[model samples]
Target: MAAPMKFHSLADKIVRTRVSSTLNKDVKQFGKKHLFDGDEETCWNSDQGSPQWIILEFSESLSVSQLDIQFQGGFVGKSCWVEAVKSGEESFARIHSFFPQDINQTQVFPLPDTDSTLTSLKIVFDSSTDFFGRITIYKLDVLGAS
Candidate 1:
């Protein structure tokens, strides 16, 4: 068997961020912060809508080599694309697109080699497993050297 892929965690470098919508206006409940809090019970829930997106900014440029996530079965994103941009760049480059299974399990997606100068990453959920297009994510980790 082959060895593990890029396994470093760069989560601490995450700075500013934006999301399409949260489950509630309350930050204490189902807020965007819960997306990376590493708590199994807490999750970032999106409102019922298609084409949801999450943009994450890092303190410095980075190259995202892997994506680790846990989705709540029925509310998972059926198909999604990940994009990244270098600092001072006007356009973002599509890094990878994937289809996640409709199950509550941590899934790891290895991304292609990217420019280390990338300062921002965005994930667009083109479709959802749920009929209403809502998404529930228990954990989301962008991995690679910081």
Candidate 2:
């Protein structure tokens, strides 16, 4: 008999580690927690600036295979890069890069499979909308196995 498959989301099982970033203090409602709460209406918005980022750390290594993200309209990540740190690694290494379109929709990115597992993931925003430079993320899902 074939066993049914199980799925897990690293975003949903994030470690207690705090997320750090430079965000607009005024937009308190749109905080980091909103990014992984599985709500499409809520989002995380950063302050108008360059080099904004958010890092998610997990308690253990995760065999991540895909990453899904939703960005807010008008306030999107124009130039961004994704990085991951494998278990036992002290630093993160670049994994992917792309220019997110200015629209309200979810984007799925397939990550290359690796023999090792990752302990942390980082997303860096080098630039954003022409007017605000703010980065608004509606949702983030990290799909993988333990």
Candidate 3:
């Protein structure tokens, strides 16, 4: 078996965040906050269908170096991309794109070392596996420095 990848976060900072789609109100306990709650069992599940997203806004610009994501089995995002808006930019620029395997695991991807001042980060889920086309994210972590 292959060993999993590991990364030491550059900065342990948390920021204000929001999601594009959340599960129905019926599952009140399962909200977007679960993405950063440090619990593997707790997750933020999209209502239904694809094209869901999550946005993280920071009080100050950060020089992000990497990102780590954990997705739930079956409900994993089949295709996704990451975008960022610099301190003064009104629009987001594509930073990274990925196609994750259909499994429950943590995957870390290295970001460009451009040293840009990023004020916001957006993760877009273009599609998901079967099961109502919902995307379930267990955790999302951004690593970098201010």
Candidate 4:
């Protein structure tokens, strides 16, 4: 039998971020095929701002090694921050942050260690605003070590 593949956490991995105006229609449509209900829209407006935040929840613990985030640039602004947190027994804490100067720019974030496990990821604007315009994510890649 084939040996069980060992996975490693995302320590010392390089993450590349990309900028886009919309989530790839193929991915969105593909995700919907597995879901029972609800539609996923690329552009959204939150009470806080025009740029909408994308929150990701994983079914199992992921030994995150790297991350790639794509932000959509609209009329609202040109820069934003990305954060990651490990889901804990009681609460969540910040693990990684990324700031991109322009839309369509790719930023690489390196992991500090491979021992970290991540359960959730969040993307939001730098500050709380009334609205953020049309934030788009093209892809999110998580490198694992184990």
Model number with the top TM-score: 1
lDDT of each: 0.86, 0.77, 0.79, 0.43
Model 3, 1-146: lDDT tens digits are 96654555533454677887777853467688888789877888888977888888887777887778888878888888889998778999988888888888888777876667888888888988865778888887888643
TM-score between model 4 and native: 0.49
Q: Which residue pairs clash within candidate 1? A: none
Of the pair 2 and 3, which is ahead by lDDT? Answer: 3
Worst 10 residues of 3 by lDDT: 5-14
Listed per model in order, the count of residue pairs whose N, CA or C atoms clash below 3 Å is: 0, 0, 0, 20
Q: Tell me how far the alpha carbon of residue 77 in candidate 4 is from the true structure, in angstroms, after superposition.
A: 7.6
lDDT of 4: 0.43
Q: Against the true structure, what is every candidate's RMSD?
A: 2.2, 3.0, 4.5, 9.4
Candidate 4 lDDT for residue 89: 40
> Over the stretch 55-143, how does candidate 1's per-residue lDDT look in tens digits?
99999888678889899999989889998887779678887898898999999988887655689999999999889999889999989
Indicate the residue-level lDDT of 26 in model 1.
59
Cα TM-score per model: 0.91, 0.84, 0.85, 0.49
lDDT of 1 at 19: 86
Candidate 1 residue-pair clash tally: 0
| Highest lDDT model number | 1
Model 2, global lDDT: 0.77
